[model samples]
Target chain A: MANEVESTPNSYPMNGGIGCHSYVKNSHIQRALLHAAKDVITEAIVEKVDITNPWFNSSRTLRVADFGCSVGPNTFVVVQNIIEALELLYRSKRHNPEIPEFHVFFNDHVHNDFNTLFRSLPFSHRYFAAGVPGSFHDRLFPKSTLHIIHSSYALHWLSQVPTQLADRNSPAWNKGRIHGLGASSKEVREAFSAQFSKDLQAFLNARALELVGGGLMLLLVSGLPNEFHSSQTNSAIVLDLLGSCLIDMAKMGIISEDNVDSFNLSIYRTCPGELEAFIEKNGHFKIEKMEELINPVRWDPPDFQMLASHLRATFEGALEEHFGNEIMDELFERFTNKIGENSHIIYDQQYIKETEIFVSLKHRVTDYEV
Target chain B: MANEVESTPNSYPMNGGIGCHSYVKNSHIQRALLHAAKDVITEAIVEKVDITNPWFNSSRTLRVADFGCSVGPNTFVVVQNIIEALELLYRSKRHNPEIPEFHVFFNDHVHNDFNTLFRSLPFSHRYFAAGVPGSFHDRLFPKSTLHIIHSSYALHWLSQVPTQLADRNSPAWNKGRIHGLGASSKEVREAFSAQFSKDLQAFLNARALELVGGGLMLLLVSGLPNEFHSSQTNSAIVLDLLGSCLIDMAKMGIISEDNVDSFNLSIYRTCPGELEAFIEKNGHFKIEKMEELINPVRWDPPDFQMLASHLRATFEGALEEHFGNEIMDELFERFTNKIGENSHIIYDQQYIKETEIFVSLKHRVTDYEV
Candidate 1:
């Protein structure tokens, strides 16, 4: 049995992130995207699998996988989406169940705590006949066996530390190489792009082996605007808030300047065209559909005040593992203070940022057609 | 080369009847539906036709046909929609110089006035195309030659005469049909349904052959509520108004009560499911997508009043052929008087009628697997 959580690297933080889970749990847009993806997947499966013909039909099973699945509660939402998609495919009369035995892989990072995954196992096992776990980034399954690959909010995370940002000598890694506030230094932009390119390639290579000809891959990742100008008021507002908070923490000497400079944010932004080019270069898949939209994630500050105590208590679950209880409390106090200071901002700035969902179909050179 | 329209049918009283061009001249809903239909047609063409491959490449002479095209300036909108659809499709692609050849067939009943269509044709020989005058209820084109089939505001017209109402021999046709309204008899309902079914079948069969496999069909038709009751205050309002006018005419002995009972409107009413089932039973296609909506006709009493003089002038061309201008002017005076008395009521009632647009792809099975 493979470890499911470790295989899906990008979603490692989701199991423990309180706000992230709830955000994804009730996301109707994400649900619709997944539904559409599932439709494409079922179509691909029915086309490639010969089970539709009675001559090829036998008592067999089929495998479906949702990589980078998180635990807590929303694992079942993914399950619900998948089931609904399957039902639609069946209603379309495009699927044949009798064939090879079904197998499903749920993969994540090695560091991910499986306790949450273990708790949600029953709901998943009941729905999917079989579930296996492993890191998909690393070899987890045999080649050319996957019928469908679905991943959301996972590809943005890099496997190793991002090299462009990690290498201090790199132009992109060095700060202040380009003009002032609002605009990113050209070097920093390049660093982010290089890191994204490397990670996306790794993602494509891994899935290329896993998926058979005519398989489908659906990905929803963070995206940047086509003509993003840093000087825009909306752009500076959130960055200024984050910058102010970091400055406050540095003044208190809670974090060093070195550590601050080492951390790289904004590593996940991609445009639809960029992703399309990447896939096209990889050569074997075709873009079926793409949708890009900005979904703002603003929380109610007035309500936040009411839940201050409960939120403080829950903050322990996040930081207590690395630091002692006292340090965790102090960090929460600072975080809460920052939240109170930024309470004047009308909408909650914290959201999925910019997002894009890409649905692709694996193109194969058939012996007869080619 | 095809004639734009043929002469009017003898059965229809052309006396002051409004032509389609009058309805379409500056309609908002019509434009919106046309734009949407254009988008679907372009996308379907892209998916079905392998434009990149030399063998499958189409000509700059694209053969586009608009069936059930009514005569007058209004047919121009459908032509405009097709032209705009093809143009946008061309621009969206990396400029393919081998543009599709354009040949448009604007088909309608033999009774349609070609003079109006000819007057409406734009003076552009390069792209703007000719009109084909004929009944779509019969064969209109060579097999598999059309790339697009577009129709609007025309499907409701039935092929033959409505089953006659008030069959004096049987009381079955004379029983009370409009339950609450002490007026309508069962004969009217039976007559309407029998006429509608016959017309709908003929309409479907005609379009079925006209649409090539893998070609697209965009249809816009006036629809009534699935559960409309004739006795309802709203439904009866129109009938009551017409009834009063007929009664006045009868008192004057201009038209006989026998003619009133024999008269049946050609308009066909359909619900979503009925339309869907009709397409399904026809077995030539499946619904790619369909939507039912109520679009306001945007007829203000004030606008109608302003256009009344021009309408009367236009009526000269149509009415002079039947009832001489003297009788036509007398009829118009009575209608104008009634409109003035119930201007607000007439405006509010007529525009609120529900309509539907069906965007369906008649899938032709390819050698490729599902």
Candidate 2:
């Protein structure tokens, strides 16, 4: 039974130190990121006119889904904040009283730590909390049932590794490096961006079918600002440093070059323009607000072990899936040392940290199909 | 898909209005009932002063489970009340920053409409809401993981109807009537009592393994009081009236008489002495509080249809399973007429309305086994 707990598909959860990425999710960062967009998200929710008739009571339930709502601490904060805002909107007489019944659906991959997520729920909320286990990239809800959708730091994840990146013979195979590490590979970059566009379209189309007309959605994801390149970004630095450490391991025959080629982080950071174009193409969601915000990483002298854990927690699932669990401790130790060396060298430099995009959308009455 | 929803066994759910007994559960009654025992439950919770030693972190999560937590509205109220009390207890101590988190597991039969139960969960509460689908007759949780358990109107339901009632050749076989309906049959009554004792022992043993030392459990269920005979109880009246109606149907060729004999309700209402004997025999739980409650059903003229629906909702699952769905409407309609006629004949007379037993037990370090 204990073995049942330890041995699950590691494609989504972080390994070691509680065996979950939730430990390193940085709830403070998540809280700060969501709290910043509270007003905008609230505004979208308030503007949602009751397009659903009271006769259609099923849809009348204020259905909200949080895509990629991993195990909590931050999931609660984000959900609570949204619900509170929606409640305030209702109390202000700006929303339908008939829609007071809120049903919140927390969605993630089937392999996500739903047990932990379900076990840590704040059960006294104003609405219903149901765990919908499925990928958000595909439709996880009934048609016209969802009223609002919110996601954070989750959409950057593609539905899968780009097909081109996985093709060993293709120029986009991402040889000897995972995403953003070998930043100059145009084929690799294009494959990630193309996959993101495709996935975002599918995501939008699915939500469009599920969300009633005039429903709302807020998406906060890692992005690349138009002014800055990936090579200069702290996220890319982390990846590059990780890649360098892996290269060092490969030299010692600890990691095979083929394993590196087989592994590519299924994340694609995009600019506001790219997302705007996709939304326009989809035509179901009318973007209310879209902006890029910069979060400067300011840990003086750096905590490499913490950084390694954060990295391990965030991406170890994929790495372990590609490279096997036997190498986890050794890989992370090397990663910690590399980050330690890099942080010391770059400590005085004002590096471009994370760029995040906040997109507020309202589902419009449209004849749209995927 | 809609057929999937409706075609599910409606025997348990009250005849399809909500397809659940939750419609008739009357949250107000539940609230009032639980509120009556607030101080006792509060005292039990507050007395739990281990205050979470860092040495023992696993058990620190104050585990509470509600066995047979049917669909919500009442489930939320009960769970929320308990949590609020626990919070107050913690707050009174000037708050141990480690205010042991509450992880509540809601257990019910697997066929119980868990979707509805989970969907209406009060997610904003202090405790976690997890749906553990299993029969509470057996162990439904990990050993020593639960701190408290609350089960309402659930224990009267035996694991199954007594086997003897269904054995045609056996003298104990109930001929043309359900359990307790043929009041003259001593053999049938003893069989049910035996089954109840056996199931209750199994129930205690299972809960004993799950609950930690010093843990508490509260059970509210339909039972026979010391002064009242089982046959004269209101529940008996409902069952007797239904049985009489079924006999009427059998004569009219609406239902088979054989089906009536085969159909035994899985309920066995016990008196305080019976329960005490069982507890004394299996000394895992020390009875802290035990008493029978009388709810005088004073309807100037009884609403027969309301009574029919109430009965329909409560026993529909097992009834439908024993009989068939074809006779459901005709049977209930006939049941309504009989109850109305019976109520008129008996309304002026002293009628035993409802006898419910409330038992609060404290788990003691006992060297006892079932």
Candidate 3:
């Protein structure tokens, strides 16, 4: 993939299904993220929703989608939490009327292992579940039909690695890097920023077509914390280590150096300003709240093994695709040893492990007309 | 020159949306019918259903249908009751830890007022709803897919009125009379009976292909009492009064006398023996319980004006089609006056009111192997 960046799956899903090391394992992180958006989510269910609104209430069915619902035990867990939260809000109403019935759609890329997602579903008489495999960047449902949409830890992923990054003549070309990281060229940063802006606009445009008036959308995505810029957080360190490992491998002649030079991770670290600017430009939704959530660190960092395994689950597929599958075990082993030897790493800085940007947008009434 | 037969609503729906005299207003009759089948439906819930079976239980989504869901306030009511009953069964056992999510399909003819159904739907956070409009006599759903099916006051309707009733050469041709009634020719009776048998078989066969093993079906239909055959019940009085009204009009040169000869209601009254023989012949479901419900007389019949209005609302379309719309008011006025003049008619013989056949069937296990 030195030039052609069309190959996707290697960089597609974080992991498959509900496994010990799969996406479910990191649910505590998502649960915390959901908790951060509880106020807005509750507000969306109670204050923002009109109980007697004919478009949604008259149908007696509530349609919801978790747009980037990767295979999960977490998917079910997060939705369950949301339902409970919404139920609590409904119970507190003065009139205390009947609640709308729920139809939940769990959506991800077409290649996402939906069978595993279905197999692990928790039984309930409260709501119905279906797996809708599609990209959130495109329209995946009937127009003006959804009442609520939830997406957590997903939007930061761009549609693909920026092709502009590979153009030698382009000012935004990214060279000698796998992602926009420490001391990355302005060109690298611009390429990633441009891709994110385009993708976010497309996402907003599609969702605008799908949500009913007074509908709400809650999103939890990775972002730069306050006072941070490109490559400043601990997330950047992971990229630093990843790129270093590949470079180290290239020097050893185990893989071609040109492959490492042309590859760039298709992801972006969004700040509040960037999020606001994108929302303003799209104009489909009215932003209710957009804030950063950087938790107070409580526990000590996990050992090298735990850290290594987490990264492995996420980046192993991408690495194996670019390099041969045989280099995976050895590559991670080197990564682990390198992290273990860096004594200054743990004490010098906060890695920004849990900083996620949370945004809640109410579907604008004018857009609902369509 | 023929026996009396009252007209069917100009053809019948009580009212479009859920309202007084709507399907919901007839709740008392349905309630009694549901209670009669409670034992078998319970047996279906506990013994017949395999809880841990993956085909249904493992996926965590349960699919159900109400085959002739005309329109709602009652559609929601019945499905709600079923969910409640199913939940009650789930709560009775220590191992009843899991209850699958429910996806309910509301089905009817393509011409059914689904818009009104959706508009009047009640709110609930319980289960999801979707409208599937199609004839139940055909395959309305995917084969071996549904778990439980409920149809009330629908199957007694033949696919269409027996063609033989209009075929002049057929022995069963119902000329000069609209339906099988006392003193009606044996040919008319046989024709209607054969049509009913054929339609019910088609209905059962379609359901057999859709239900999972151990799935249950509950049906409530208008039928004759133990002492009554086709023409002996009070239901015949409706046809009798209708035919009389039509013939009277023809004598007056109000409606073309020949028009009445070609019109027949596409409904049949099913007795226990008939329903039983059909199930036996179809050989897909086991008759867990089949009973005749005969209530003690309690209330006086409605006045002719009220009766005429109710009939008008239901059969007005069919009536308007066969007879000119201009004659509707005059027709019902004549009908009301005729009943007023027949004060001694009630004492002539007992009319079959408040008698319906209730049957519950369990899908046989061998057929579940699809």
TM-score of 1: 0.42
TM-score (0 to 1) of chain B for each candidate: 0.75, 0.85, 0.85
Report the C-alpha displacement of residue B362, candidate 1, in angstroms.
Answer: 2.0
Ranking by DockQ: 2, 3, 1
How many collisions per candidate? 35, 14, 30
Write candidate 2's Cα lDDT for B1-370 as tens digits: 0112112232153222245334435334444556565665566567643334221233335767888776555667667767776677657765444456666767655455554554454434555455654456655554555667888767877777778877898777887666663256888888888988887888899898777666778887667666466666556666877888888888888778887877777778887888888988888888887876644443333666666666776677677776778778888788888887777544545555445677888777753221
- TM (B chain), model 1: 0.75
Q: Which candidate is the best by DockQ?
A: 2
Write candidate 3's Cα lDDT for A1-370 as tens digits. Answer: 0111112442376666556556556445455556666665666566666545556555445677898887776667668766765566556653756665566777776546554565456633256555554567766665666778889888988888777777878776665678874435777777778888998998899898778887888888788754466565656776677778889989999888888887777778888887888899999889887877654431235466656666776666567667778988888888887767752563345554436787889887843332
Show where candidate 3 strays beyond 4 Å.
A1-11, A18-21, A26-28, A94-96, A168-171, A181-183, A296-299, A350-354, A367-370, B1-370
lDDT of 1 at A96: 49
**lDDT over C-alpha atoms for residue A177 of model 1:** 19
| C-alpha lDDT values of all predictions | 0.48, 0.66, 0.66
Those runs of model 2 whose alpha carbons end farther than 4 Å from true positions after fitting are A1-11, A14-28, A47-60, A94-99, A296-301, A344-349, A366-370, B1-370
Candidate 1, residues B1-370, lDDT tens digits: the string is 1221122231221112234324334344354555545555555555444444332243334557777665445456666656665665566665644455455666655444433444345534234243443455555554444557777766665553343543646442432221112225565555666666665666566566545555666677655556554343332443344445545665698755554544434444665666777777766666777776444333433554433443343333433443344555555556456556765665566335555655555645453121
lDDT of 3 by residue, B1-370 (tens): 0001112121233345455434434334344455555555555566555554545554355677887776655567667767666666556653746766666777765445554565455633265555554467766555556777888767776676777777878887677777664426877777778888988988899898778777778787777764466565544665567678998888888877678887777777867887898899999999887877654321234455555555555555567767868987787777767666663563244654436677878887653342
- Whose DockQ is higher: candidate 2's or candidate 3's? 2
